[model samples]
Target: MDDEQQDGRAVRVERDTMGEVEVPADRYWGAQTQRSLEHFDIGRDTFVWGRPVVRGLGLLKKAAAQANHDLDLLPDEIADAVVQAADEVARGELDDHFPLVVFQTGSGTQSNMNTNEVVANRAVEILGGELGSKDPVHPNDHVNRSQSSNDTFPTAVHVAVALELAERLQPAVDGLVLALEAKAEEFADVVKVGRTHLQDATPVTLGQEVGAWSGQLREAWGDVRHAGDRVLQLAIGGTAVGTGLNAPADFGPTVARHLADETGLAFRQADNLFVQLAAHDGLVAVSSSLRTLAGGLMKLANDVRWLASGPRTGIGELRIPENEPGSSIMPGKVNPTQSEAMTMVVTRVFGNDATVGFAGTQGNFQLNVFTPVMAHGVLESIRLLADACRSFTEHCVVGLEADTVRIAEHLEDDLMLVTALAPHIGYDKAAAIAKQAHRDGSTLREAALASGDVTDEDYDRWVDPAAMTRPG
Candidate 1:
């Protein structure tokens, strides 16, 4: 290591396998991270190191160190220092030290090295050694012992995705389901005209409509949960390729056990280390489930906005929260802003699903080269869906109210109510009655009474809107 000055600031020269490079004196990242920054200054999509991926990496490194110590592969002092340093990284205390972008190596080698360097340097500091000295602990031999980026990065991704789905996205979906269920019960007696092909069909209680939306979300939540479960199998021991190589046979299972204990998740070693390293099918499944959820959320939001279309001129069957001005030019206008936001989020999730699916197909041979972007896409989808669900539930679904007067008007005027007459009067005569009412602009009762096809008492009994909402 060389101590140097650059632009009147203190700098340190760190050497990797390639050569020596200058890293900022204050940052913990070393030569490999600096090389990645200089070469792949590609995008603004840097990993937010304080989020799940970095936290997962930190937790994984700590587990790896503990496993190595338990296996007698690492000394106790080095393992203790590394564990403490890795814990700090896991808790996001060292977030600023990890400054790599997500678009680096496809295997995320640079990011894995970044973690190793930060932990090793910090551990060295803990042992009263100079930074970048490689004195007490080597980034590879000690900190990254018995692991490779090919295996470690994928394992970290699985841990991150599983934890995120369980801790954030699933809870948000549950909250939305509960909110819609409450609305369903609240509007149990509200009768409204139903539409098919954008034309009036028959009467239905608002409760039924809201309950259907809740059912869709509950199903989607289950799909996401099941998909998340598939990623709990990790690829830790698969070292460089599918082969265990330098790592012991029990290394992967040992690390996974430690991780499970730390995170309270059911993490385990993958059944096939080769498949875990080569294909991202598990993450693809998770993304597909998220896409399904996005579709459901889109339908629910569109339905809400359509039902709450207008207080004066449109459907006007439901009222939503008036959070802010809907338009800059129109006064007293309140648009379904939450619905619009949710639909936009759905579109993004759809795009992410496409990215993840395509990335999953790019596994060349021994290892997938698209792990970093795949991780980014899946994690972004989860975060966006979780946040949008919570926002929609709080700002829109919880505040929904039925416009009873408008619903009554629509229900009373709908000509499809004539369907209740079809079984009483022959279908042909019922059709004629609806056609006559539409042509003459008369009520169904007036049209039927004039036609001598039905009696007033029969019309009253057959066309009860509340009774029409249920089976006879």
Candidate 2:
């Protein structure tokens, strides 16, 4: 078995073209995978980056086997074995075998070879041979017959991102929108003082305010879907440098069709593999969409936090649901924890978007080297945003209650309510009334009455705040 005892441990000496290296007897990887493990120790991130890529690679290999078998390139038995092994990999039965980090190899060649070795070893074991044999189903000659890391890695990025947005992020965002709509309906009759530039402006129903947040989320969802459409175009058939070296002419299209069937997502070969492989524009677009969504979430969370500021002093027009005690020393203090968590997610997404943009630009000639980081950034944003949306929906939006008494108090006390008298009493009279209210430390209603600007009947008819809120 090429194994020897050294320091009471059995080590297998696996030889590649460079030389022989000692590998663990129990692992499925060969010399190259072993070398990567020793070489790239920059992060303790583990094989997390490889999960989606490996899953996509599994699907790619399965499709390639089918396509090659149909083309009479791969024999039926080996193709069947490879398909079974790849399916297991796709289902994440062998994630532990992929031990490389995200920071390894710019093209993710090590990760690709890592998948190849694992699939090949598993295929060999399925064929009644020992692991690491590279026997009936060799890693390159069989499993990776018509593929290159250049094409496969980028294709994996597309498959993982598109599937994640459709299956996870979209549903979470939809749930948030629905929750916001529910809140809007619940607070339909509650009127509050609107603010512009953090100064009192006029009057608005709480329903209108919450509905604006819902509209922002809807727009963000549309942007995510548009970006996802770009990722559905794969560079798989392009091979090493977009030249399809040693691959069949129809390999790309056939494999893409099989991938579409496997994923139930409309995956297509890129119109030009050169452009697709050379740049990560699709991922950058997705990150940009995520950044936009983050911005909307940040604004909404800040609005909620400010609206629910204090129980005694600040603008308490909305009561945020208290899930936990806010302070250790202070009594009866409840914070907008959900909003805080949501804003934190927003900040992380902003940083991730920046990282993706920078990584997208690191492409050289025919291959983007920053693929793993780009993939990690996109996936992280999707995962964090999905969780944040669901959490914010449940903890804050669903149980949020409008402080209607405080809202009415604020509306009655706001100086900007004099804006209602602008058309009827003239701007100069309205400005004088506002100045009198501020100078006399009186309410707008009290000062307007004292000014003798209009009769009580005229004031009642013209200064209807609710009527001011609607379209003229």
For all predicted structures, in order, the TM-scores are 0.98, 0.97
Q: Taking the tens digit of each residue's C-alpha lDDT, what string does model 2 give over 1-472?
A: 4888878888788766698888777777778888999999878675555366677777877888898998889998999999999898888887777788888988889888887888888889899987666788899899888899898888877888888898889999999999999899988877788899999988989999999999998998889899889998999889999888888989888988998998899999999989888898999999999999999999999999999998779999889888999999998899999999999999999999999999898889888899888988898899899999999998999889999899988988889889888898899999999999999899887888888987788778888888878987
Cα lDDT tens digits for candidate 1, 1-472: 5778999988999988888899999888899989998999988577763278888889999999999999999999999999999999989999888888889889999999999999999999999999999879999999999999999999998988998988898899999999999999999999889999989988899999999999999998889888888999999999988799999998999999999999999999998999999998999999999999999999999999999997798898989999999899999999999999999999999998999999999998898999999999999999999999999999999999999999989888999999999999889999999999999999988998988989999999888888889887
Each prediction's total of clashing residue pairs, residues at least 3 apart in sequence or on different chains, is 0, 0
Assess candidate 1 and give its lDDT.
0.92
Candidate 2 lDDT (Cα, 0 to 1): 0.87
C-alpha lDDT values of all predictions: 0.92, 0.87
TM-score of 2: 0.97
Model 1 clash pairs? none
